[model samples]
Target chain A: MRRGLILLGALLALAACQQTPAPRQALFVVLPGDDGHIGAITVNDGKREILLDRPYAASESRGGVTAPVQTSEVEVRQVFGAALAARPILPVHFRLYFQTGSDRLTPESDAAYRAVFDDIRRRPVYQVEVVGHTDTTGVAARNQDLSQQRAASMRDRLVRDGIAAGAITTAGRGELDQAVPTARGVDEPRNRRVEVTVR
Target chain B: MHKFVWAGVATLALAGLAGPAMAAGAVIGQVKTVAGQAFVLRDGGRVAARPGDAVQEKDVLETGADGAIGVTFIDNSVFSSGPNSQVSLEEFSFDSSNFKGAMTSEVRRGTLTVVSGDIARSTPGSMKVKTPTAIMGVRGTTFAVQVKP
Candidate 1:
């Protein structure tokens, strides 16, 4: 009976140690975005609020209270290496310029579009949004048609490059949305362009 | 368990009616990359996740000790979770015209990293993450969360 009691006491002690585990913790860290800009984060734990605005800024909340702390890239990598490495490909944007009053791509833009096409090909699954714009030199209605033609032309090239037809969407903003605001009937090279966003 | 089985049946029926591409709920994102053992729990059914798989709202992502998964949302928001993590997409919506949206995710355990996108940029504080101990709000930023089990 004495031996049994000793065993029971030892088991109870082990249980006590197991039950007093470390307190639950939640850590939040802010980092620079893909665009190289740092934004802010707000953490609320019902009873308190903490703000982390700078890159590598960090905080830990325990038992519903939080406080800010210093962190470095090395620490972040040590803790979140897998999660960071698993980050998805960042969205890419391309602007292809067009010749004045036409849907034909400028020589420079023609070379640029090959890079965009190659990027789209590399992704196993991609969604493309092509928006075309025209300079203010032409009539609004005509510019709208020309802008749409420009977008459609780009879409056709993507389709020929083997992108699924359903994966691409096109829009024509025409002179209403110019890269450079200009007086009516002004020919702005920057405004006559097609913007493509691939994700 | 019975409730989950029934929910799975219902989801299967809806998928048949609407087709896979137009799966019952709104497809908020896609699984961009998955390594090792990862699965998406939807409507009580656990499906092995693969690249390009559509991720709907309310789906739970589970990653094993050797697993990791990345997701990219319609609003360009990107997120990924490390091994042994359970993350749930509680709510998500986006308006392409206005670039306004709200996203709320829950990290039950393990680590998650996110890069806020157009939605968070256009409407600061609209994106949030909930943990066992606290809630995090993103204001057009990149952030990471680690929830200890």
Candidate 2:
């Protein structure tokens, strides 16, 4: 149903290539913007010109009736994937913070662990990077060992969650790469964390 | 000779961008992971997807109940589609060296998250995702969209 329109658009693009081509119109719309909350989206399909003002503001009212007829529009994507099919996909990077001195995930970040798992499970990610960091609070040497323990704990948890243990690589940055830079012996909650990159 | 000349020009243009050498039809990205009942529809045909499957431009992607999928594009743009969502990649043009290009896709229903890439970073206005009522001109590093069906 929706697929026909997309095919028609592509065929038209090919046909137009032979004729005096119009600025290649996408079957879908491409918006321009200046601000985040207040902006405009223009939909010009040759004949129809739509200037939607503050579309985000209007979506709240019209969201209930949302359904585009064309269901499957794919192709422009394959051109890239097919072009570099041989190149490896880059790993996805995610960061989760922990408690100040403990290896336990922060209450907020613990909730975020599900999202990280979802990302891992969505793809055949062979490499999982779990690097732990700590606030500049303790001795640098001890912080390194503590951070490694934190990293190893995350690795095991990912394994228990179904990812292969062999797929994981762990490291501990200790007091390095603090989210909020501080002088030595400073306690920063944001600095205590594990960074995960899945490939 | 004309075809050869045009091909030569295109090669030069692509070389300037350090673009990937594309086949007659290229696959822009691949499905890195899939869960539940996700499907890929290409050429009017629908099939379930698995890890390491390629996702081409002009392909319609959908996720059923209990389904989800993650995709990574050549330009480093990542998309994650949640259950009951329909998405399409309508247009894309990327220049590798300058990292300047445009990408346009649409989601008909459900949830989708896009992690921006070179195209969006270099030219923020070039990345767009349209839903039923609104078109999103992505400006941030990452964003999520939810369209009501």
Candidate 3:
């Protein structure tokens, strides 16, 4: 047991070596949305600090907002835009495929599911939208049912693994969104999949 | 906070609409998104960066070990830098109406992502994103640039 502890300690130290320092200075333009869902962050237990809900000019390590000595409307107006030309901004997206005609995850997708779970676990406030898709081989209605089944299956697994059910929203694409494009009635292994977007 | 960032931003928009165009060194952008502790070192003063804060030319943007930020320039171009990164806007000129101007930013270290906007679209070769190893000429495309630590 002591030897196992030592190995674990060594592994953690190795992981720690990969993290680089964060960049503090940047200029941004808020995209169109209610309160702009730019991104969310959670600090490591001791070393992380985050600034939430506001357009940040700069923030210190203790979550302190920096006051700009010089600022003017022409400067601000130069950046903020009219809502007329708003462009949609997208966040993180992950897709995992299912076994043929079944809601069960293929081996590769099972591994992907675990990786995504790790990401979800890191955020203090996060929501995931998971959509399931299927190959075009089946009838339209049946494909819809299978796709939803796959979504439900993944949701259930997540809940069983201690993730909050409320954190997830599931939908079925019914073979409508294919990862690898295929013709009608074609059985594309890549088309049978689930897409999870986490933010 | 004596004044909110959005309020400052609103006034800026009104000023432009009223036809008194800003001088060359006007605030060109705001800090759109920040995760973790990022800071701006300007004129020998250091300030913590938050979303909505105005950004100017020649400001040195730095990220702490756990910090990262996303910036939207006046021309609607987007730039994001990953942790332990350092970058600065070298030159910026934009006429919002026609999106006619050029932008140059240098990534001294770490990772950066850029999405070309109106300026690049209108003037195909108006923007250049420089990293330590190579100079990237952006022409209306989304791309990521990284420098090994």
Candidate 4:
């Protein structure tokens, strides 16, 4: 019995000698959302779990999981500057109105067009989707053609503004999707508009 | 024309094997920005990545020592990675009408930045990132991850 205990102790000592501290293999940092809302991240390393709920909260794993820690913005910038710099801007949505029975833009929509164009131009790369909508003022078949014309016209305007024609796609949804639900033959300014989404 | 036809056939075959999240070559995202040497590995082929390139599920995004890349998903989620990185879009599905979906991405190595979009915002715990050591459940947040070799 004594010899067996001695052998077991020797095995334990040998096992201890073979172990070396493991290096940190990963790092995770939680940041705030665009609207300044701080969300949470639940991290599981199989053995333990961490909930990072605050901005700049961080966690790292070595051989074993570590407790959550509060990191600084400076550290994040220094460590993840390249990844952050590569992040693309979120999408933007714009609406432009049109005159009744015509593809011409209203005066107010014409004024709003500048900002939309500027926003698209400011991005390094963008994809524009122009969807034309019409009010329930005319027959569905004619309205479909009219909406298509409005969409094509808007696409032409963007092309004229120097935006690449290949980067923009246009679609027309006739009185099917009215901004304001209206009875047949009713003209709704809100529905007679083109929506542009830039990404 | 021949290449396009073969590609469609291959996509259809892979879609059958990829389960539900992938449906006959659906475009899940687009490459918004790329610098230096970035590439997308899809279906056993590695091609240089460029802005405006379509990104599909099961694609592996890789960056060289001097490279960086950014991708924007249909759900509005954004993912960017620094040099010497390998990230795989394991699974993704989005419903435009409801703006709800589930996504899972795995970072094999290097640095990654994630901005959760409608998927995580509309349904918490539906978006996740997997690393060598841990799995993170993102709840409509922006976050950074680094994996060392």
- What TM-score would chain A of each candidate receive against the reference chain A? 0.82, 0.58, 0.56, 0.73
User: Which pairs of residues have clashing backbones in candidate 1?
Assistant: none
TM-score of each: 0.83, 0.42, 0.39, 0.76
Question: Which stretches of model 3 miss by more than 4 angstroms?
Answer: A1-199, B1-24
lDDT per residue (tens digit) for residues B67-110 in model 1: 99999888888889999999999999998756799999999999
lDDT of 2 by residue, B2-112 (tens): 999999898667755675443344667778778788888865558898776777877778988777777877567778776777899888788643568889999887667
Best by TM-score: 1
- lDDT to native, each model: 0.88, 0.67, 0.64, 0.88
| A67-106: candidate 3 lDDT, tens digit per residue | 1223333433333221111212323568888888999998
* Error in Å for residue B131 of model 2: 1.4
DockQ of 2: 0.07
lDDT of candidate 4 over B1-149, digit per residue (tens):
99999999897678668755333468888999898999999876788999989999999999999999999888878999999999999999997645689999999999999888879989778999999899999875689998987
In every candidate, how many clashes are there?
A: 0, 28, 39, 0
At residue A55, candidate 3 shows an lDDT of: 30
Q: Model 2 over residues A1-199: C-alpha lDDT tens digits?
A: 6799999999999887888533311222111222243334344333333444432221221322222222121422321222222223455678888887889899999999998788778654455668899999979999998899889989988899988887677888888778799999998888899978776
Model 4 chain B, TM?
Answer: 0.85
lDDT of 4 by residue, A78-195 (tens): 8788888889887788999999989999999999999889989988788887888899987999999888898899999999989999888888888887878999999899999998
For model 4, the stretches where C-alpha displacement exceeds 4 angstroms are: A1-22, A46-49, A64-66, A100-102, A134-149, A173-188, B1-24
Better of 1 and 3 by TM-score: 1
